[model samples]
Target: MSTLGQRFSRWMQSRTLTGLTPGPHDITIRKDLRVPMDDGVDLLADLITPIGETDPRLPTIVIRGPYGRRGPVAGEARALAREGFPVLFQSCRGTWGSGGVFTPQVDEQRDGLATHRWVREQPWFTGSVATFGPSYMGYTQWAVAADPELAPDALCLLVTMPDFGAITWDNGAFALRNALGWTQMMDRMIRRDMLPLGLAMIRPDPKLGRAFGVLPLSDGDTAATGRAVHWYQDWVGHERLTDEYWTQQSHTASVPSVTAPVNMITGWYDIFLPWQLRNHAQLAAAGRAPRLTIGAWGHTSRGMGGVAVGEAVAFLKEQFAGVPSGRTALVRAYRTGEEEWHDLPAWPPPGVAAEAWNLHADGRLSTEPTAGGVTAYVYDPADPTPAVGGPSLLPNSGPVDNAAHESRADVTVFRGEVLTEPVTVAGEPVARIQFRSSQPSADVFVRICDVHPDGRSMTVCDGIRRVVSDDGFDEVTVSLWPTFHRFDAGHRISVQVSSGAHPRYARNPGSGSPAFDAVTLHRAEQEISHDEFRPSFLDLPVWAG
Candidate 1:
């Protein structure tokens, strides 16, 4: 290592993660090592190794992703190398200096297995191999997870899901902002355009916002990136999970087949939390001991990144080096509102009980169902309800005060009495609504917020569903994101009902036309009924112990 790189590593150890013990060895990086694939395409990789280590049996941690190898993952690679584990950080095909056309999630299985086979033949390899990284890197790990002969010895996945298609068409509604924003980001990165990426980090870019509002969602890629993106076009075109296109790109079927020890970390406001939890639950149901940690963060929260690195280092050390992991339990979750961390034997800990809070016509929430009426709102596609704060790729994501959003005419608010004591919610919250729309199609967005004594209502978790029914009322069950939040004393629990959270989710055409192809805009008159026969309520998983 050069003097500057050595000094930087020391600085990172001191400032970034003070709790971790400094590794004993100096690190060296070998740049641009070309590894040939099955079809003779060469993928670029950088091998990070300890300078003078004699232990050739130490494990190698392989991290693969489309992002440049020297980006954010460099710190993680160097950290592991310093601790005596060799690190191979490879760029996916068609990214950076790698060969082949870039098609997300398609080439990973073949490319990853080929890379691992090459690693085992290297002169420095003699021990078990583990795969580590976050987001798309996690996807790369899952892509080869079911390979009977090439499965990794261990996996460390953070803030990612296996089914990219499910996240693309979440709840049967197109994920406009996330899908388009990510496409634009990758396009900019590949073309080396840094201005927009820099501006997006500090504030929302107006041009990108305009791109999200473009009609015929198929044109969004061109509006955002100045050219049509093939992946983005395919994402918008495929609307069903049962499609063969989606199945070909998905790795969800590999979860039950994974036999390696696993560690997963995610955030409360992450777009992939629901599916990530599903993977965790699947592993647990099969009697696999996978460790999981959930933090109070958005997808891009800096805090989440810091925590993930620490957790990964500890878990990898425990698995490969026989080190004692200091964790108190199998699962660790951060509780919002109260801002406390709880360690438990499992998630949705055993003491949770479902409690129903009835919604009244007068905008009051109570335990007892009473005589109520319907609340109506008009949702105009031209000026759809705007997204305030939730799971988004932008910097403005996470829990934000929704006071202004709640005051909009297109939104309906229900409030419960101030809590005299803290009410802790530990699991998923479901919203059961009796809804009807004037048009053939509409969307129902339900959000749960904690109203502070100072009148600031901050979002906790929310869910959206695309509805298609006749003019009469139809029962809709919108399952919100699972949460661990506390409603503090003197704070009231609030629920916001609206037709759309524009840009975050594509606007429902209300004419039964596909959002990506629709040219006609129809205004939808939406109704939420809370009566004796069709009572609307929120079912919360309240912890009883």
Candidate 2:
């Protein structure tokens, strides 16, 4: 280690890790741990090991992430280390402490494998290892496992997309706004020292702290904004769902190659629920022992302040201890009302049944077949349906309830009668629509919401369709992302149809041109047909609670 590294390590050990009983110690915070790729370019990493546990050969947990390794994960690393595992937290090449230019998931596969190899060679590492983390950190774990030679024994991924292209960039036609925010945050990290940049962005302004509220301070540095700008442009440039751009970021294509046992943790309201479900299904189909736990809360639902972190720790304990297959435990903890943890045999529970609710002309949703007519509404890009609630990116500084937006003229609301009994929606909800557009092509947005007796419309799930190359009049199947929610008795289920969920999803110009650059607005007359030739309905998965 360099002199600077040694000095920094000593300072952290003496000051930062002093009082906490189960804290990190003998912290050798080195910045130049070399992870060499096949092409000879080396990635850098920062290695921090716990004190007092001097086992020269111990099982290791490799955290290869895009964010700086020496940042927030330190506490979690210490806790895992206390449980007798050596933790290797490495920044991805060209990221924080790493030595390459940050290009998101494109270089992760190579860098991840290299980091795993480097970790194994460390004198303190035993042959066995695991990979884990949340979001981008979680993605690196999957990328590392994709490498044939570097596959770990176990993997724990939380709230991460199975494929960046499908989930993050353009989910069908809707662009993820949270992804744009994340790219901006990462852009700042890429241009400056990790600690200072993080502090500046998150620190409350001394004078206007309360007035500015929780918005991260922005100095308007373009270099600090490069990641967001590039990501937004790249996503917009690729209009087709099956285009090469999307293909390049898809991990779904490589699922057959991963050999590690997987544990996936996700929230029902998470923006990446579709990707999570797809990943789980693909892994199970590939004969991998994949475990999934879906919670009812949004992104930041785990850890201390949200729900119980003990559940996650217990799951990891069982996996690391070589628990038998059937004996392994599965836990799903929700945040609302009861806030209790529920144990289950498998996800979707096996008892969930598909139920269809047809959209009727008179602003009604019903299970019985109905004669359908087209409901028309004009979608103006200047004032799209504003995003409220549902799964969104953090720091989530927006309103949690979306009931107010239901009254918008551009948004069409269709409600079902009050439920006589409780119905639990436990899987993906799909919207099948047969419609004709006045223009060559247009996009449609669908939102599934739970209406309380007092008239509060809480959005449960949503889907978006970009009709870029539609044949004049056609029936399209829009797969709303999967979700788990219980509709109580007397509560009504509702569907909100609109053209856009502004800022959450980029507004569709309805101009029939390129999805990204066509700013021309055209009036589209949409017809939802429900006859034999044009049957339309929402396919909901109902569970017997």
Candidate 3:
């Protein structure tokens, strides 16, 4: 087993791995591992192991997901198996070859437990097991970890969340585009399973564009996917986090029961970055120091120019042997602008200072606060501000230059002077604004950017908030997800204020009614104020070192 120190030393010495190399041992594949569940339904899996060994059992790594057992997972299973680590690629119920209906987010806990139990009973099991995968597959690890009897020895999770709401709803606004896209993907999986010959490709949804514009958000699922996704309908119908439906499906409900070492992998632009942070915090609070790795990429690509498998493999090796990870930091984040990775002994590190930049009349952001200034913008849902990109899982995700969008009159832009010195930030930025709107309800979308000397606005991180209006000036606070970035000298800090990140978040409708049933669209006149009474400011987390 390799400790964290030993692994980091090796990683620092030679960081030139293209893809994981398989071990010298010839491997054999078993296409059917029928894992019986409590309900008597068998979940199907493909098992990969060393060809000739049968007496000395090997460690197991189970990747149970709704994704098919043979498609995306076969290569991964082969590679891990080649390295002497046997892998079980299991399919979630009703999709691929698994039994029972496929209701997303439900049945994962029990199904995961059953599969793990079956693995331990097999002769090839070394009595040590770990769970791995991204998205819902990652959830399977946590689900089983919650069960003391079935919990894996370790967990290697990637770009996934412990709860669905964090992906579909953030700060009170519905995540329209992500929810629709994901539902469509799952719907296609089921149809393809039934008609493999004809449904070669998930036929494009003709109602896609108009579907997003549907009056009732709840009914938009069938319009977009051309089929009924019951879980999605349930998602849009129950908008409250307080709903019993969500509470029962939430994976965090099992956090206290998870005692295994966990390696949490996520990207800066990953849709569930915020939720991953929440998971890290909850684990720490439970007295578990899980390892974390954040990079500068989106949901699909772990990192554009970097690979994480080496570190992940090392982490798993340590866990499987019941060996300590050794002295180390909790966070290992790749700073975006700097294009470098740094280790923080603790998240937000120690001795971090909070610097405030006040918004002023000239669209200037500085330490000097100006008096009696108001900036206004018109928010039209039909012509709502589109998502420019920061954190998202939709078709158009990752970082896109926002200069063109910032040039629009509908966006209120505030910028600071070129930096005379460099500034490093390792946590979420906070925006406190005194706001007023013509309507009784509104949505506020905010972004923090790095204004290059050449005038290009590169987004660092962004956030959105849905406000139930008081019809007057009211203070609102929004927090961007935690980030690791540094603005070099001569770079300017910028803040953008707008009404909506349409399709990214469902348009607020401005009617103060149910978002789904909103028929009439109204334009809103919004104002951002800064003065003695209402001094609006953007809080930056500056690291001393």
Candidate closest to the true structure, highest TM-score: 1
Regions more than 4 Å wrong, model 1: 12-22, 54-57
121, model 2: CA deviation in Å?
A: 1.8
Model 3 deviation from native, Cα RMSD in Å: 5.4
Report, for every candidate in turn, its global Cα lDDT versus the true structure: 0.87, 0.65, 0.77
lDDT tens digits, residue span 82-126, model 1:
777889999999998999989888889899999999998898775
Regions of model 3 farther than 4 Å from truth = 1-17, 52-58, 193-207, 302-306, 322-330, 394-396
TM-score of each: 0.97, 0.84, 0.90
Worst 10 residues of 2 by lDDT: 211-220
**How many backbone collisions does model 3 have?**
3
Model 2 Cα shift for residue 184 (angstroms): 1.7
**Cα lDDT tens digits for candidate 2, 234-283:** 66567565887767766777876788777777777776778877877777
User: In model 2, what lDDT does residue 197 have?
Assistant: 52
Clashes of each: 0, 2, 3
| lDDT at residue 463 of model 2 (Cα atoms) | 82
Better of 2 and 3 by TM-score: 3
Worst 10 residues of 1 by lDDT: 13-22
